[model samples]
Target: MEGQATLNRRNFIRLSALTGGGLVLGFNYFLSSCTTEQGSGQAFDLNAFVRIDTNGKVTIMSPNPEIGQGVKTSLPMLVAEELDVDWKNVQVEQAGLDTEKYSRQVAGGSGSVRESWESFRQVGATARQMLINAAAAAWAVSPGECTTENGMVVHKTNGKKMSYGKLVESASTLEVPKDVKVKSEGSFRLIGQRIPNIDNHAIVTGQYKYGIDTKREGMLYATIIRPPAFGMTLESFDDSEAKKSAGVSQVLRIENKIAVLGRSTWEVMQAAKKIKAQWKDDGTLESSADMTQKLHELLAKAPKDKPRRKDGNIAQAFASAAKVVELDFDAPFLAHNTMEPMNFFAHVKADGAELHGPIQLPERARKRIAELLKLPEEKISVMMTRMGGGFGRRLMTDFVEEAALVSREAGNIPVNVIWSREDDMTGGFYRPMYSYKYKAAIDKDNKLIAWHHHSAGVGGSASPDSFPAGAVAHYQVDTHSYETPVSTAPWRGPTHNYIAFSEQSFMDEIAHQTGKDPVALRLELLEQAKNNPAGKVNYEPDRFAAVIRKAAEISGWGKPKAANIFQGFAAHFSFASYVAQVAEVEKQADGKVKLKKMYCVVDCGTVVNPSGAETQVEGSIIDGIGHAMYAELTLTKGKPDQTNFHAYRMIRMSEAPEVEIHFIDSKAAPTGLGEPALPPAGAALANAVFAASGVRLKNQPFIKSGLFA
Candidate 1:
């Protein structure tokens, strides 16, 4: 495959005059086009750019926010790879939300690398070509005779080389080339190599600063006391005792909550604990039992909305089937539980507002703060800090808004609003609770005929077009939703996270009931999809099959292993990437099942930063398994049951299975890796548990299924 296609005219390139002595190349090949500044005739937001200094140092600006996805390292590799620079000579800087200089700056959906793959490469290649043109001009030779290697422009005929830094001045004066060609796969040196994460050294040495560690001059620490439970509203508050506490400066009511401001976090926390607040339910206070009961009722009733997807006849196919099997799966709400919790620093004044903190959507946060503080967007500046963890929690700017509001309320004295672990767990948004009902029809010849999936949840919970849809002849998917006071947000893989488990586990059950090999059954369905697709296919069937086959081969599926060892397999496609996972479990003599190891195969196109990609896959698998095995959040009378680590369990190092990751070799453009590997891990483990115990787990948190001691 070509390294990159020819650039269109609309994807313009420009040479900017930098005050410092260096070559600066601004290029735009953005997936989404942003308007250029009026009368400037140049696209300011070029997606990415490269700056070469006189010291032979390369500074590449990363446009997107980094949330531990290793984009800080992998994205710059895209530029350095095409720039032909040695890894040691390159440095990366996180670009802020400069609409005129950056585009696609958010950190959600794992689109950072995928979106910038081609464009960033072009940015580097364009600069390299400019430098070669300068060298060719000096040598009085054709530009075609010059090639770049390790930051040097080489005259292949005379064996003469010129450092990029030496030609920076002449290169900056030259016109930007439009037809610059990127390197092919065979020429890649920095990419597909095991480059360590750029922040690894700082992270391990405790020198990296997260948003929670943010501090500003004259900053006051604030701890808010919002409604303790959902559906409740603050009736009144008495802050006389809070004001009497030592170090407590002020206690004021903001909206429905009281904000305790002090010199230190501990003081504010203690002072807030002394306040007397009364809350009353403004609506029906709900419990977990009530939500589960409502879910059952909705799934049992016919969906009011039209089916998300439909192919062939569903009622007739099941009615005419030789045999049918139905099963239900349930999942509970989960807290994000980011290590740093929720914190942001904001100083909102009449003229402008300065916001600094960790946020996935820095642009969105800036706009929200501007709207709330009644300031112009240009007047509000938002800077992103390295986050401790996101997991989709930072996508919501509520915490950032709270900090801005508190700062404004505190007389614009630069306040940092922080949430305690309890505040984060009890009040933060969660993954919507879900229940799925799957029914499949098998023909007399034991061939799968039809599939009907019904899911009901607090919000949407089904991916209608995701696999099994285009594979089955008669397929239909319906979803039922109910509104509640509970808050829900996008978690890791979002809908794919839970849907894959239910869908893949149902496939395993069908295979067992029909006396077919699970792995063979999936491959057969994939073949059907390839040969005769039922409807609009959103994924590449060949790519999906490749991962499945690779996973089976690596796990030694259907082959004999150690005593009491059993295996289960699952595959899913999400974020434009395909992944397959095989879970290995050991059935102990005590009748308990232990997950020993996991084998994961991914086809995310060309792997950039092999170490980072492997780490992402491994972390995703561990996160998926941890949530599937132990995580659960429940409510009683609108109050959370578990608010801290002592009550809410996580997968420990002892319980975490050893994960082996493999990526398929492909020349296709790279895709997202942060989420694709997560969707299949739960299902693989669930299937393996059944293979060992002969008991099919139908609910989330397999630990609660009585299969483990």
Candidate 2:
């Protein structure tokens, strides 16, 4: 708090004396959270992610993108919790892309907390051990006799205490502890407690700086004019007229698009519109109808290759079953529609490049920028800004690439590239349109004998190990993919977002056909998976069952309710977490269904920052429900028909239902909370609508299905 902390080496940890005595700690690991795998067994380097001053002030670097998922706050709590420091004395800063310093810095798939749980704790625990060692040396006592509490080292016998600040000088001279004990779950103070987001005040008071707010000296605003359609290639462009526009500083062509730079966003946008461009269709223009037909054809035929997962003889089971239920579910392409449109600021000097903006994958962006500028990876530095909203859009570095390209093309002038809402919506990288064909065979006793699922989509498919695979005795999963010019990427829960709706709704249909309760049916399947798993199970059946059971009990699953109100239930496992949701709907006087309330139960292991955890669950539910009810993105001749929010149709504030969230108490390591709750929301809502009315919804954008229209 009273001295400056500095890094002594490029990628090594060293503690040296400061003017007033400051402490800095560096941590490095090969753990990648992008997937379910743990450490890569690769060599590690040191990078400073924690710094403390002699005044007892602490600063921690949050190495993941915020994306409104609360990682900006919750991640730091992990370090502070292990350091035994007061939350009031801790401040968090966003870390940039540093391969030597951090791993899995990208924020997607809800892996931020899960992947860092142990490594971040080690950082604090190791530091705390050093401080205690220093205190014991000063007192001439055993290190084990000293403990830490609220940034202070205490001796139990004499009841003497010294602030961690006082031990900094001595700690700097001590050897690093290879293994330091971490606090038990029962001893955690800040983890389970309800702590507000670190940036709550700044976010609410209009003081937060999102990527769109990025500013630098002599930075020119820019916009791009891309081909109107996905399959169209730029043939020619005339920007002479655009160059005459006021404030239009420069106009240049970059690859397939033309960039217009000016003093203001409005001027650049207006000048970009004045450019005359010619696009030539490459005989690959795709329409929504084409994609739909392709999916239908693919789903209709069995693949020639082996199935992704096959447990038993599915054909024989279906032929011998008493009854077979078959259905098809469809979900259209969806755009991210982040509040702050894609924007990035880039300064590409002759020797190195500096990029500042909202990017979910900063390391990936840095690597690409280095390649584009023909510089070494170390020559490129990326600064991640607080994002307005990610939901997986910022994971693509197209905007960042555009800014860097424009900057370099404009003679190394710092430039900020901004996308209009229309541009953001029309730009590719949407949630791929998906279709699921499910068939279930039921025996005479109403027991499921077999399950068969076929999924077809444009550049996507269902998980082979997803639920019901290990529950049913005979099961098979086959996926078919079709190539398209339109680009697609992960959106929130990715495949689970649409697959959960289809899977859970079909389960509901099975219950309705067999005259059994829906909740009871799921429990029965979970029990089978837990006790006698039929195949490889990727999730904890017991933990999954816990959330399902808890949600049922809290929502009064089988109990009586008020008239005109119907309830539905759904559960899913994703991102190493489990979530079960119950939706309540009211039948209006005119017979239309309205979402009344939502009850969600989640088990992401130990909860860090309960307030932020609740916020994530609530936001996921609203987002899932909003998209299922109203959001839609369609393409006509490879061009998006909906270019802005008006045509895209987001959920209105008044339409958001009341939400009640419950988290199961657990000692398990914290998992992901950002996405698990979202996958089940659409399914729960659709099932609720069916109970309110005898309608079975199969398509997404329920409003278009005429149930709520």
Candidate 3:
């Protein structure tokens, strides 16, 4: 464990050389998800990491992180469909880090679905073509007439067919298809249908290895003690008492830090607590309270860091408006709180290093490790384990880098670094807190005349401002960012989730003021986008209205359903898909909002798996609801305030609402399903609560702001 030794590194998963490394390449895909395989002979390219073995099992080296968006199943579904393989017979393997194959494994900004779907399809189509070519040669027929159906190459006219497994050996010898025609929507047998998750068996049985479960022979378990505050380096450490403890191997200072290595993780954790690690609290000039105060002030004068969208003259219209209303809303920082804490296993070598862990950004982490370890790109091997829950938390490589650093410190010996519950919580990185200010005017005709919106926040520095102030007549959307030591990445719907709560709530207010129904008001604006127009809204007005109408029909809108249960609605277009949500809420005497039910309608063009899409949409609604009501990651004096499940909360089974999701029938090519439904659900819930209580909740974690009261 103390020397550079790896017994079965090659036996585990061998890497292949790359075909493309750095060329400005627009991603090309077929019927699946994203294109990742170009193929080469060397034993380590990222593309080669994705392979169809002679057994006909497709090992999709998932480039995207899988905290729990189900990319592990959905992404491969894209490939399996295009490959014309039986979804039941397919197997997906996590990929090692290889950017030559994966360009954007950084999973955030709701780009996972729209970006990777077609590309993965290309990989399948290419493989399918090769298989068909093999079958054609074997049957001595033209390749044109041979089509694929459910993992078999069928002589379409003759009805003779061969399974993918039967043709694997022959297919491997055929020239890979360079420009093969992908199957049309009408010809698909799998792309738009409901299918079970491929990895569901592994997950249900706990056989799914996460980053925490990664182990190696002669690998030492270790724990790290980082500085309490950002920008603070280790001043000194005393591990004499820890080193003498049972099961402890050696407590050595590596890279100006103290690392406790032991035989077991429990032992290392015990030894880690005894080590008196101290450092100067070199943090920002402001505390959490200080930051809060500054954020409120900044919300008013949200500096013009960037203008995301602007059209018409709000100032000119506001100067001559009848009535104007202004409001400010705030949201605190949030922690990912993945069921599994951050962990990684690495074996650093002089020539290269092999790393495996629970990480979202696999390709990026590999490159970061390759550079941080000071080895050639070819020497680094990064592998992914199924993530317990990603939620945009696993997209960073900080923990992976630390593991590699410690492995090199241990003389390039194989080591698995484990982060305790505390380490995982306070380790570093968070969703940035935010504040928003809004001002809108009502004309004499009771119509919206002017709109001005400014949003300032942290954690969103890496996110693109996605709201266009909704489908408004005269609108302006302004955005700005604040710098903090807290590292932040994408979280589900990112900015749209928060903005939806704010913007959609404001839309409801305007609708009430204008004597128009909430749904009617949205329909009017959507009508504008449909008739004359605005710029990009991935959502077509008719399509968006279709979901709203469909959800309204299912929700019994405008009908005498119940006196206590109130309904509210919101719709949004994101990640190249449109989703509309109608929420039913009932107030409780305990001052908590009980979600009675939620109806969601989605139109994402072609559904590869209708059942999968429905499940994802339901999960998204619950995910957004739980985070909106109870999830908040605050800090005190540069340290995390919540460390474990007891303090942090997630939507539990009994608390989750009955989510009914319906899909629209469409012939459009296909769109994404991962995150499109998340944003509007939170907003719709808030609106429903407002209708019930006549209260407009502005801040996140509605319970904190007395939404029920």
Per-residue lDDT tens digits for candidate 1, residues 133-243, read 999999999999999888899999999999987887676557667667788899898899999888889889999887788888789999999888889998898888899
Any runs in candidate 2 off by more than 4 Å, and if so which? 1-13, 16-47
For residue 335, give model 3's deviation from the true position in Å. 0.6
* Residue pairs clashing, model 1: none
lDDT of 1: 0.86
lDDT of each: 0.86, 0.86, 0.72
lDDT of 1 at 594: 90
User: Which scores higher on TM-score, 1 or 3?
Assistant: 1
Ranking by TM-score: 1, 2, 3
Q: Which parts of model 3 have CA positions greater than 4 angstroms off? A: 1-65, 101-103, 110-113, 126-152, 155-178, 230-233, 254-257, 283-285, 302-306, 461-470, 534-539, 588-593, 707-709
Each prediction's TM-score versus the true structure: 0.95, 0.95, 0.87
Give the 10-residue window scoring lowest on summed lDDT in candidate 3: 1-10
Clashes of each: 0, 1, 30
lDDT of 2: 0.86
Between candidates 1 and 3, name the one with more favorable lDDT.
1
Writing each residue's lDDT as its tens digit, candidate 3 over 547-600 gives 878888888887896667788888877777778889999877765566788999
